[model samples]
Target: MAYRATMQEQMIRKGPWLEEEDERLAAFVTLMGERRWDSLARASGLRRSGKSCRLRWLNYLRPDLKHGQISDEEEQIILQLHERWGNKWSKIARRLPGRTDNEIKNYWRTHLRKKVQEQEQEILQRAINNAVNPQDFLLQQGDRSCEDDKSRTSSDILQISDYGFAASPYEDRLFDWISGSSSGINEDVRKHNEVWNMFSSSSYNLGFVSASGDSIWDYNSSSSSWNLDEDLQVVKQTWNTQ
Candidate 1:
């Protein structure tokens, strides 16, 4: 016949304490009164180790223990202390009257650390949204300026004629030079200029002109578009009566 092990000869318990163990431990603590843990378990008839008993007392069973969510004031103190001590949790815990180093460390990792990570992610996303695309942004501004110029009156068109050729002879010469030059201008720039000249000349009479009279039109040639009303495109024909 195999002999069953008695409770005294059983393997020492590890992990979660039972209600009976808690009751026995509490009773032992009430009589033996604190610390001296190595002998406390053996004397109390608990199947727990001294370290386990010490931890349970310090973390859960202490009379002054505050049980609930850590307050904001406690969280701030923990952060400040952690900065100074750098994971010296015991040192940090001392500042908080009832909190243990283990509890503070758990709070930092679970709640405070996660909150910081979320805030950092939000900041990074915002920065990406606000960030400018240098090439595209400059082109957008340039296109907007061109749109403003396209709304010019007839007087503005006449003013452009006066300023474009008369004020600067080199302006006409530049075009002539570009057209006839052996070294070709950039094809996109050439096309943009061609579009501008078509609008400005008396032959077309679009009656719209640029204020700056600056040449080099800004547009996305790939998405080149026109919003002209057909009535606005009327040609001026010279009449001869004999």
Candidate 2:
């Protein structure tokens, strides 16, 4: 019996089913209703194994099986599903009608695999190119000038000017008060002129004020103290007069 079994196994066909074999297998599958492939193979008198017969029927020989180049829409679906499910080809095949797991797997190996790898490499290269060094970033920030900071501050004030008619309300009022007061220099205008003069002077530089830890008000040599509340009240009266 062992000798006979060995002879039978040796006699079994492998690789590339003939057209006659395919016809015979299909007829047997139709009569038997696609179950017990071992028995079906034996009954059909085909030398191919049950697994081989099953694969052939499902992958190619089936009448319902689709055989053509995969469409663009189908290719996109395969890519999306492959990304989500990984190498679950049988699972992926279930989503696509008439496409076998073997066909899908082979397509992925031949076509989609390299495409996916190239995409991953491109993304990695882009990330490598865009990566910023911490030290370089810090040095770039440190290299920025105080003049640039002042210009940015001036630009911010100018941007605020765009929201109003030509000049901001506070700037318009301050300019009007200064222009009007220049003709008849009152006590308030005199104090204002003193403040302006202090700002313009080289001794009381605005640039060094932050570093020196000195107040702009400290430049006042007069014994009379400047109260912010009193100054605000005088400014309100001046605005009222205007």
Candidate 3:
């Protein structure tokens, strides 16, 4: 019995099935029905194993098996189900009529696996792009605010220039004095002070010069001191003449 079993094992074929073997297995399965695969293999008189016979019949020889290319609708279904179940090809195959688990598994390995990985990577990249860091956002806002302030300051300087104040040191000093000291002064007094300060600034050459080129009113002379009443009288005379 042992020698006979060894002989049977030695006679059993392993590898690709021939067309004659396939026909013989199909005939035996039809005659004996699809149970007791070991008995069916022996009865079929084909040197292939019961497991091999069963796999070949179910995957290839079955009349209901679909040999055509997977359709677009079926591909979409496979992708969705794979996302939900993950690697359960047999479970996935049950939902797709006429598709074997082995066929589905091979398709996934060769084609769909890479597609799914690329989709996941694309989704990850998009999420990274949309997620802005809070610190970076604040820095951008701060930079924009600083730019706005610089633009506003430039516009103010331009406006001042348009009004005939050229933003010199003399003008800055005059502006400081007016802002600091002229708040409580009457309008007439403030105007008088403005005129006085303009004359006091060294940059202004408004004083009358004699023929010898000496200033008649040397307001620019540091050593010269004049009474406010006298200065006011001079200013009044000059204004009335103008």
TM-score of each: 0.45, 0.54, 0.52
TM-score, prediction 2: 0.54
Candidate 1 error regions (>4 Å) = 1-10, 117-242
Q: What digit string (tens of lDDT, one per residue) describes model 1 on residues 177-225?
A: 3334323224323432443455445433332234445431221112244
Tens digit of per-residue lDDT, candidate 3, span 71-133: 765676577657645777876675566788999888899989999889767666655576855
Q: How accurate locally, in lDDT, is each candidate?
A: 0.57, 0.62, 0.62
The residue pairs found clashing in candidate 3 are: none
Across 97-208, the per-residue lDDT of candidate 2 in tens digits comes to: 6688989999999999999999877666655566855434333433363334443343333322223222223323443455345543243344344443433343323322
TM-score of 3: 0.52
For every model in order, what is the number of clashing pairs?
0, 0, 0
lDDT score for residue 146 of model 2? 34
lDDT measured at residue 125 in model 3 versus the true structure, 0 to 100: 65
How well does model 2 score by local distance difference test?
A: 0.62
Query: If ranked by TM-score, best first, what sequence of candidates would result?
Result: 2, 3, 1
lDDT over C-alpha atoms for residue 189 of model 2: 43
